[model samples]
Each structure stands twice: as structure tokens, then as C-alpha cells.
Target: MKRFVQARAAAFRGAIGAALLPLVLGGCATTGINKGQINVISTADEVKMGQEMSAEVAKQYTIYNNAAVTAYVQGVGNKIVQHCDRQDIEYHFAVINKNEVNAFAIPGGYIYVYTELMRDADDEAELAAVIAHEVGHVAARHSTERMTAMYGYQFVASLVLGQNPNACAKLVTDMAATGGFLKYSRKDEHEADELGAKYLYAAGYDPRGMVDLLNKLKGLETTEPTKFDTWFMTHPATSERLARVETEIAGFAKLTSPVRNAAAYAKIKAQLPK
Candidate 1:
């Protein structure tokens, strides 16, 4: 009887320890990607915080106002989302009614497709390429990875590194407020390119959309986005990353089918914000 009572006490202690974990640890390292360059911080914390902050951003921008346009974005988005390895994520995608010629994703499968990108795509694969890249961010666990990196000094907070919880909270709050959820390092950029290309092929979209999207960003780098802060900082479409993506697709098994859905792409273009 005494042994069983002791075991019950031990079990209770274990439960208490588990509950206290997040408070002390702050939830870092969510994805399976190695501790290399990608954001691999605690995914649950980042996703929860991202959902909180996303609510604020969503309120400011009206979602894309057209049903057919929304449907098209959702359809392409759903196809790519399914092929992703992160089965736990639902990937809630929406079209933001902004004319910034950009798209981005948040942790926990929240993806945003701007009207500008929709209007900009000349083919359906172009859109798929973008979705795959965003999905790449999710799959790579870049959100949590970036958060771990973005906090930059959470290790300092831990007893393992430096033990500074207050500093850790400050760093996280700064990231949350500034939208530093996940921005890939150059290595992360290349890795996502590779994984995104793989997924692009898997989802039945030609990998060229990766190249096309990069090319478009290269051209657009000459211009400034309408609200230029978060997206630009993270997605640096460099010449080298772009070039490597081309090499990857070229090396893949040849895709005999046409990649672009030109007619569908154009019909939706008319509805986007100019």
C-alpha cells in the first residue's frame, strides 16, 4: 500500500513538472529539421503566438473580396498543403486584399496570399510555386526555427546557456510584436528551395514556378512593397538562391506536361486589386 501511494505521489510530481515545462522552457524547437540554419524553436509556442498576432493583422486588411478568386487561391493552396509533411497542421490559407505583390505564411499553417501576387501570376503553377514555398516554411518548421533564432538569446535564459528568463521573454515579445516569426537564413533559403521544389513536383505542379516566382521577385526588388517591414526582411530572393532553384528543377525527372494554367490564371487576374 505504501509503495503504491509513493508511486501515486511520483506520478503527481511528473504531471506538475510537465505543466511547468512551457513556463520555464518557453516552447522552442518545433520542427524536425536539424539545428542548422532553419527556425526550429518550440513550434507550439510560436504557432500560438502567431495565431494571436495574426488576429491583429487580419483585422487591418480585408480578405480578398471575390468568391471565385478566393476559391481559386484556396484550391491551389489545398493541393499543396496536403502534400506537406506537417500533417498536424490544417494550413488555413486566405487571400489578403492588398496590392503588395507578395505572399507569406505564419506558424501553425496560416498562409496569406496577397491580391498583388494573384494578379501578378501569369500561370497557375506560379501560384502553386508560391504556395509550396510557404508550405516549405511550415514543413521546415522555419516559424519555430526562426523564433529560436529570432529570440537570439533564449539559450542565455536557460541554465544550460546562461539562465535569463526575463531576457528570453523580452526577446520573444520583441519578435512577436515585430513579426519576426520566421525568416530563413541563406542556408534555410536554399534548403526551402530544394524541399519546395520536391513538393512542387509531388503536388503535380512543374518546378519552374519556383524559378518564375524568384524571377518575379528579382524584378520586383527594384520596387518597394506597399507596407515594407516583415515580409521583405525574411524573404530575400537573392540571385544565388534563384540560380540554385533552377539547377534543382532542371535535374529533376523531366515533367512532360505543361505547367501553367494560363486561362484560369488570367480570369482570376481581372478580379485582384490593381
Candidate 2:
């Protein structure tokens, strides 16, 4: 009898997998399909969650703003956005009124840059590297991957905690803190670098933006790790990654068609709050 029950359970699991196959396959018809099996969450769901969390964070912290700085950031972001295929999503770029040299992205195209990052950046191209990297996170749907993974874990967490459905979800979201562990696998990091590099090149920013940014961050780490923020926590900048980024940029011959916007960057820096 036990053997029969086990066989039935196996059969049921197989059936469910088969049924889910169509939903997964047909999901490509929807927007934001990049690679297979990595179903992009709906824009509505992404925006709702991102906006909620973003609002909470913004309320918790303050936003730094100056017309010049704000305009420069938006301009850099817009240059990269033009190269992206996902235009349906709303993208906003702003500097957070914080001392940390970091940048992060939310699911529905919400991105934040710390004033510290802007202040430390040598040129607009360096800022482009930061923007492109954050955009890669949104484009690849890393946020959704995190939420989906957490949901699967919550299913088991619910059974163990013996909580009501609503309570379980809240507990799971808080405990998992997807933003913290949104740290991707190694392959994902490499892919993001490639994507960032490509965007920088296409956006008319020198590919060296990536290399320069990585090197600058490396120097900062030598002085102190606590000085940097979201970039290090979310994305690693190892010596190896720096070497590869340099090599990658060396291959871009036409990138010199236009140079970094140094004057615009300096003008924006003057407007930042003390």
C-alpha cells in the first residue's frame, strides 16, 4: 500500500509538471522574455512590488537633488535606456541623499544612485557604467528570480512555521529580504558585465567606463570597504573581473567615436549638497 501511494505521488508530480509546461512555454508571448525557462514576472506585479518597497525605502531615507546633478543622471540613464529593448517599463534615476558610494535597481525600472557614487565618479562615462550595471539587473529579471525563489522557500517555510497564509508570506518576505540576497550566481554576474559593456559601447560611452569604474572601486576598497555601499553588496568587483573588463574593452575599437562627458559631470558635481 505504501509503495502504491508513493507511485501515485510521483505520477501526480509528473502531471503537474506537464501542465505547467504550457504556461511556461507560452509565457514567452508576454513581454520581457530573454532566455528560456526564466519567466519574467508581469510588469504590473513587478511595478507594484518595486514601487511599494521603493516608497518604503525613500520614506526611510532622504533623496538628494540638484537640477544639474539630477539632469546629468537622467541624461546618462536615458542614453543607456535608448539601447534597451524593454521600453514599456518606466525608468527613473535619482541620487539618494546618502554617504555610501552605491547604486541599486528595483524590479519595475526604479533605480537609485547614492550621491557618494556621483561625487566620486571621475566623469559621466564612469556614471554610465554604474547605470548600465543597474539596468542589467532589471533587464535580466533578477528581481523576479529572487521573488520566485523566495516563494518556493516560503512554501516550505509555511509548513514548518504553521502560520496562516498571509502571515506566512509577510514573515517570508521579511526573513528572506530578497534585496539583500539578490546577489546572483557567478555566471549571472559575468553576463551583467557583458550586458553593461555592450550598453556602454552602444550608448556612445567609452567601454573603458566599465574598466575605469571597476578600477576606481578597487582603489576605494583598498582605502576602506565600509566606504562603498550597494555596488559591493549586490555586485562584486574582483581583480579578476577588472582584468576581464579591461580585456573586453580593448576589443571595442569604435568606442572612441565619442568621449566621456567630463564637463557635464563637473558642472553637476558642483550642485550636490554639502
Candidate 3:
């Protein structure tokens, strides 16, 4: 009887795999950022997946409730998004009340920055650099790409279709505990840094801000390793990355004056809870 039950379970698994094969092959799509590369998730479905996962993220983290600060972040993010490559979807930025130095972007353009990261920024340019990097990830469709690579097209399609209702929640839980979909490949990270520098320059912010932000995070990695844990996990900062970003920034035309906006950022930073 036990042998028969095991055989049935095996057959059930095989049947499920067979059923999903068609959907996986049919879902092949190309990314806007890299036309040569193929993605199994469509943009519309990626947006749906992002919407579901964002709701789960909200349930897991406390969103900072200050209207003025929220608007400020949205404004900065908008400046970056206007110059980003992917404008098909509207971008949303919010602040999480947690005191951790981390920021991440979900599929479809939802981005979250922790309060500690905001507090640590010395100027608006620094903050904008961070937001632009996350925007870079969104524009490149890195999160969904990573998800498709890790979980397979069928599992990702199931999450978007809501066929596996609990899967989104499980993904969010895993993201909070481990990096999950938030953890991107090194190549993805390099592309984001390069794109972010370009966006920062086009948006009228100093591209050097990206360099400064990396340097700041590098310092924190040594002095306050605990605060940098989450960011370090998802976005590893290395000397090579910093040097590459510097080279990218150096290639840009020299601006007579670039935005730093230290005073404005100071006023907004003052509003955060002590």
C-alpha cells in the first residue's frame, strides 16, 4: 500500500510539471533594456506580480507615516524616473520606518528606502543616487529576471495568476529573512550602477553623488556593520564596484554646477523620529 501511494505522488508531480510546460514556453518575452535577452514573464504580468508582492511587503514592514517626508521621497524618485529607460509603468517610492541602511526595488517600479538610509544621506544628491540605483533595477527588469531564473517561469506565472495564493506571502517572508528575489547577480548590480550614474547626470544631480554614496556605505560597512547588514546582503558594495562607478561618472560631460541640495535634505531629515 505504501509503495502504491509513493507511485501516485510521483505521478502527480510529473503531471503537474507536464501541465506547466506549455505556459513556460509560451511566456517567452524580450526585455526592453536588453533586447538580446529573453524573459519568460511579460511586462503586464510582472506588474501584477509586483502589486501582489508589494502588498505583502507592506504587511511585513511599517511604512513611515510622515506625509511631508513621503512626498519629498516621491519627488526625488520622480526626478530619477523621468530620465530612466523604462517609462511604461509608473514608479512608486515609499519610506519604511525601520532603522536599517537598505533600499530595494520590487518588480514593476515599487521601491522602498529605510529610514536609516535616509538619515545617513548627507545631501539630496546622495539620496537621489540611491533611489536612482533602485530605479535602475526596475528599468532593467532585474527583479523579475532573477525571479524567473530562480523560481522558473511556471512558478512566477502562478504567483501572478494568484493560482498559488500563499506563494507571494512566502516570497515576502523569504525576502525579509534571506535576500530572496532582492538579491541580484553581480552583472545586474554593475549595470544598475552604470545606469544609475547616467540617470543621475541626466536628472541634473551630480553623478559624483553615486561615488559618495558608495564611499559612505563602504565606511558604514566597517564602522557600523550591523546597520549595513541588510544592504550588504542584497547589494554588496565592493572596491571594484566603486571604481567602476567612478569611471562611469568620469565619462560624463563636466557640468558647470550640479545639484547637492544639502539644506533641503537637512530640513526633511530633521523630521524623522529620534
Candidate 4:
């Protein structure tokens, strides 16, 4: 009886794998950012998917209730949004009330930054750099690609694009917060940094802001490990990442007068809760 049950289980597993093979192959689609890269979800579907995930994230994290701080973050995010590739959808920027230094982007244009990250920035440009980095992820569709690759394109397509189901949103929330689901690959991180620097410069903010913020993060890794853990946990920091930002900044041939806007940054930072 035991042997018979084992055989049946093995056969079931094989059948499941065989059934999924065609869907996985058929679901593969090319990315808009790079023709060589494949993505499963379409632009419209990705937006709806992100909205659902954002709603779930909101349930987990508290939205900072300050109007002034939220407005400032939105203002900076909007500037970078103008320089992003996906301009069709409106970007939503919100501040989490948490004191942790962190920020992340959902598949669509939704981005959240912790108030601590805002308070820690040296200038408006640094804050813009963080927001721009998240924008880079959305523009490159890294989150969507990551999801499809991890859970087969067909499954993801059925969940997000096919039906506006709660199951897809729940899966996204679980994966994003816990497992390494939403965590970007090293290549993805580098690409985001590159695009972010370009957007930073294009938006009239110094691309060096990216480097400066990274340096600060590296410093915090030593002095305030717990505080930095929120960011470093998902977006691991390395010397390579820091060097890449510097290299990107160096590549800029003719840089305009990039705005650091120290005064504006100070005013905004002051608005955060004590």
C-alpha cells in the first residue's frame, strides 16, 4: 500500500511539471527596456498588478500623515517621473511613518519612502536620488520580470493579468515582504542605478547625489547597523555598487548646474516627526 501511494505521488508531480512546461515557454515575452530581456506581463496588466500589491503593502505599513512631507516627496518623485520611460501611468509617492531608512517600488509607479530616509538625506538631491532609483526599477519593469521568472510567466499572468484576483495580490505581498521574491538581481540593481543617475541628472539634480547617498548608507552600515538593516536587507550594499555609481557620474560629459537645494531639503526634513 505504501509503495503504491509513493508511485501515485511521483506520477502526480511529473504530470504537473509536464502540464506547466508549455505555459512557461509560451508566456515568455520581451521587455521594453531591452529587447534581449524577457518579461511576462503587459504594461496595462502590470499597472493593475502593482496597484493591487500597493494596496496590500499599505495594509502592512503605516502611511505618515503629514501633508507637507508627503507633498515634498511627491514633488521630487514627479520631477524624476518626467524623466522615466513609462510616462503613461501616474506615479504615486507616499511616506511610511517608520523610522527605518528604506524605500522600494512596486511593479507599477507606486513608491514609498520611510520618513527616516527623508530625515537622513543630506540635501534635496539625495532624496531625489533615492526616489529616482525606485523610479528606475519601475521604468525597467524589474519587479514584474522578477515575479514572472520566479513563478513561471503563465502562473503570474493568470494571477495578475487574467483576473483581478485577491490571490495574486496576497502572493505578491507575501513574496515582497518575506521571501527573496521582490529582491532584485545584481544585474537588475546595477541597471536601476545607471538609469537613476541619468534621471537624477536630467531632472536638474546632480547625479553625484546617488554616490553621496550610497556613501552615507555605507557609513550607516557600520555605525547604525539596525537602522540600515531595513535597506540593506533587501538592497544589499557593496563596494561594487558604490563604485558603479561613481563610474556612472564620471561618464556624464557636460553636466548642467545640478541643484542640491540644501535649504529646501532642510525645510522638508524639519517637517518630519521628532
lDDT of 1: 0.65
Question: Which tens-of-lDDT digit does each residue in 82-112 have in candidate 3?
Answer: 9999988988888988778888888878998
Give residue 274's error in model 3 in angstroms. 2.3
The stretch of ten residues in a row with the least summed lDDT in candidate 1 is: 151-160
Model 4's number of clashes is 0
Q: Give the whole-model CA lDDT for all candidates, comma-separated.
A: 0.65, 0.67, 0.81, 0.76
TM-score of each: 0.71, 0.77, 0.89, 0.85
lDDT of 1 by residue, 79-195 (tens): 887777777656777888765665666666777787767766779998888888878877877655554433332332251233453543443344333433344576766776777
Q: Output the worst ten-in-a-row residue range by lDDT, candidate 3.
A: 1-10
TM-score of 3: 0.89
lDDT of 2 by residue, 1-274 (tens): 3234335435544544544465566664335525554543566766766665565556555777566777778888999988865677888887788777777675678788888778888898999998987787777766565544434423322333444435334523442232332555566677667777878888888888788888888898778777654445455556878887777877877743666988878888888776
Q: Backbone clashes in each candidate structure, one number apiece? A: 14, 0, 0, 0
Question: How does residue 108 of candidate 4 score in lDDT?
Answer: 74
Clashes of 1: 14
- Deviation in Å, model 3, residue 211 alpha carbon: 0.7
- Candidate 4 lDDT over 127-159, as tens digits, reads 999999888888888887766555555556676
- Top candidate when judged by lDDT against the true structure: 3
All predictions: root-mean-square deviation over Cα? 11.9, 8.2, 6.2, 6.3
Output the lDDT of residue 129, model 2: 91
